[model samples]
Target: MASFHLVSLGCAKNLVDSELMLGSLLAADHRLVDTPAQADILIINTCGFIQPAVEEAIEEILALVAVKNEFPEKKIAVVGCLVQRYRDDLVAELPEVDLFVGTEGTAGFADLLAKMIRGENPGRLVLPERSLMDSTLPRVLTTPPFRAWLKITEGCDNHCSYCMIPSIRGPLRSRPVNDLLQEAVRLAAGGVKELSLIAQDSSAYGRDLAGADLPTLLQALLAETDIPWLRLLYLYPSGITPLLLELIAGNRRIVPYLDIPMQHVSDPVLAAMNRHYRRRELESLIAVSRQVLPDVALRTTFLVGFPGEDEEQFLAIEDFMRQHRLDHVGVFAYANEEGCAAQGLAGQVPAEEAIRRRDHLLNVQAELAAARQRQYLGRTLEVLVEGVSAETDLLLEGRSRYQAPDVDGCVYINDGTANPGDLVQVRITDSQVYDLVGEIVPDVGLAKEKNTARG
Candidate 1:
């Protein structure tokens, strides 16, 4: 049995795919290693959505190549978007890599690599992908046992001009409701308290199916699973229907948080980027969300410095951000990727200018997030304890429903005796720009916590 060290790069969706790869290899009797030097094979699941991500992937491969040199017999495998996107280019550019797996990562990888390693010599590249994912496939949960990402759908139908996901990952394919339910049940059984549903287009889940949609699937998941908190991520603004908002408001199991990826709101820029929604529509969306889901922590991402985005257009985006004061916000500089529609468009923003806009907006969001965090002070909320703090073992760190794992900040518990994965009441003592300072209070029941939070 060959020992392998797999490095998974990019988003949470990619991480799930990495887990699937790991599961496939392990099921085939391959052992996993913690580091490159300890392994006979090194696998890299890379992201190539944009040029920068590709550069990052290349850097990782070069680092691994150095390690591979130490043991001349050790094999290197480069997989995922980088290979899917620039397979021909990568094969020529990176002869050091032996195996190349694409986005359609399936059980084929396990068998193919096993044979190739035994037969092959110094260095080369090889591979293809097929099959949809389901509950039947064994996955080693890479995240903490308390929290896991449940990717509901694969690929993207919305082909934004500046984005390459549709080309790299392909079109939408939602998992069956029964299949998802089975997975949820398995996760709950394995002690996962928080399961966040993720996808390229989450709100559009089950659109391909005749009878199933997001709400229907959500009801089933809530009714069936013992998991306490289920959060939604990467929902397009228009897809946040009134019925969906109502369901989230009424059910405590469905955490009061929404992750809307509104790339831009300016009409001209939105049109150029091929986004369907308008400024007025987004305003209405926020207004309705605030009215219906009062406790909801709204999060969104904005792409600044698109090809046609001028100073006036960018100001509109900044103005909208300042007006909304969203709970969480992420800003990204537009990537002028090759083959994207925007690459041929006129009036491209300069790199320094784009970075300037990104940094400025991030600073604005930081101030807004700091102000928004104050509301939690002197209130009670349920926190999923995540063991000792990274900063200090003297303190414990956990996440509230408002805070999504990794992307959002944590609640640092200064005085608390709770194990990891334990769901307990935390009284908000203080707050930061993004993080929170709290103490565990066993006495504050769920009902009391809700009432206290409302006050």
Candidate 2:
């Protein structure tokens, strides 16, 4: 069996694709290695959503190429979003690569590589196909055993002015409800405790299909799967119906967390960005969510420094942030991609000015996040242990419902004996700008019983 090393760089959605590709390789008797130098084949699954990601992909490809130069026999395969976006066009730039696969035909990658290794020279193979997923497809999980990501849809329909998703990923294509349910059953049977549903626009799931919708799918998963925690990511604002919120509120299995990507809060900015909802609609959504689920963690992302974004529009976002005091906030500066509509828009924000705006919003969020965490102090929130702390082995870290893996803060279990994936109650002791310090409550029933005595 040929040994291979795969490096996946991108969002969790991209990671799923990498997993799919790995499954194909493994099925074809290709062994996966831990390091690029230790393998006969090196695979780089790259992200090309924006300019920064494209640059990162290029850096990774060049770095791998440098490694390949030392071992002339070692072959490098560059695949995923970057290759898909540009197709065979990357042939001129990175001629050192042995293979170039795109977003589609992931399952057929092994056959192509076999042909090339025999000197057939498969060249650049960016076919018009898909590796979105299949219920029966064999996949090797790259994430922690207890957690997995379920991509419910492929591509995107929302042609946001500043986004390259629709162009690169194509139109929205929701997976059949039965297909997702079967996949979820497999994940649950395989010991996955937390399953995060992901898509370019998660709330838009089933709109392009027959008989399936977000709430209906959630109800089925709740009834069928044993996965303890179900979370949704990348929910567009307008599609977040009250029915969806109510279903989430009614189910303890569906953790009280929502990742609503409200790019901006100014009417003109929203219109320009092609976001369907206006500022008032966003306010109404938040209001209804607060009323329906008081303890829900509302996580949102903001894009600062869009074209024609003046001080007034920027200040409006700051004002909205102050008023909402959202549980979690991610701020990003807009990128002017080659084909994006915003690239041609008048009154472009300077690169330095964009960075400044991004920094300003981050500072605001830091203060707000710190304050929001303080509210959790003394409260015993359920946390999923995520193994040893990256900072120190003396500590264990986990995440509460409020904190999504990687993107948000974590709860540091200072004095606890728990395995990864164990759901334990933790009493918060301290709060930072992003993280929280806590002690595992050790059997929530026991902890609650002793709360008065401990006090």
Candidate 3:
């Protein structure tokens, strides 16, 4: 059996694809290694969603090529979005790469690897066809023991002007509800307490499936098993339906958190970016969420600079942030990717201006996040213990329901002993812009009992 090492870079969706590819490799009797130096084959699952990401992917491929040069017996293969988007160009530029597999043609990864192992040059296998939904193979999760990213769908149909997702990933395709449930069940059975539902647009889930929608899938998932937490990510503001809101409010399993990537608050910019929601509609959605779930932790990503975005539009976003006081916020300076419609549009903001705008937005978000976290001080919250700090073994790190895995902040447990993956009650003592220091409450059962008696 051949030994291989795979490096996955990009979003959670790309990580899921890499995990599936790992499972395929394992099933084909290939031994997995941690580093390229220890493997006969090195696979890189890359991202090409944006310009910066494309550059990073290319650099990573080159780094692997250096390793291949040192070890001529080891072969290197590139797959995923980067390969999907620039297959021909990459093959021409990076001749050191042994194989280049596209997103659609990834199902045959095992065969490709087998051919390369036997000294056959597979060249570039960039399949133009888009795979059907529910066709995704099973994945071998690469996350922590307690948490797993459950991808409900693949690809995206939303051809946002600045987004290259549609070009590389193809159209939106929802996995079967039954398949998702089975995966969820398996995860739960394997002692996974937290499942982060991920996709290009999670809110647009199941529109392609017959009689399936976000609410319907959530209901089905809730019915199947009682996972400790079901967190949603990449929810489009335009697709936040009333039924979905109801599910978020009523379902105890669903955490009161949403990651809606509203790229811009300005209506003009939104329109230019092909975003369907307007400023008024966004306000209404936030209002409805706050009305229904009073403690809902709203997280959003905003693009600071885009084509046609002016000073006034930037101020509008700042005003929105001040008014809304989001629990978590991510800011990105827009990068013009090749083939994106936004690239052809006029009024491109200067790079320096874009960086300044992005910094300003981040500064605003930092203040807002700090202020919001301060509110949690002195209040008891449930945190899932993830790990202990290396600097100080006494400091345990975990996250509340409000905090998503990587993008959001974390809860630091300063006192009390808890193993990784244990859900414990903690009292917030101090707050930072993106993290909280808390004392883990010992005797959680006693506290619950006391509260129950008082009630």
lDDT values for all models: 0.88, 0.87, 0.86
Candidate 1 lDDT over 1-455, as tens digits, reads: 89999999999998998898899899989999899999999999999998888999999999999987778788888888898889898888777778777887544678777677679542354445444689998888899998899989988898989988988888888999999999999999999999999999999899988899899999999889868888999999888999998888877888899999898889999999999999999999999999988888999999999997999888887899889888999999987898898999999999999999999899988988999999999998889999999999899999999999989989999987999999888999999999999898976467444322232
In the order shown, the candidates' Cα RMSDs to the true structure are 2.4, 3.4, 2.6
Runs of candidate 1 exceeding 4 Å displacement: 120-130, 447-455
* Residue-by-residue lDDT tens digits, candidate 3, 223-302: 89668788999999989888777777776668889889999999999999999989999899999988888889999989
lDDT (10s digit) by residue, model 2, range 176-218: 8898999999999988988999999999999988888999999
**Model 3 worst lDDT run, 10 consecutive residues:** 446-455
The TM-scores, one per candidate, come to 0.96, 0.96, 0.95
Model 2 residue 369 CA deviation (Å) reads 0.8
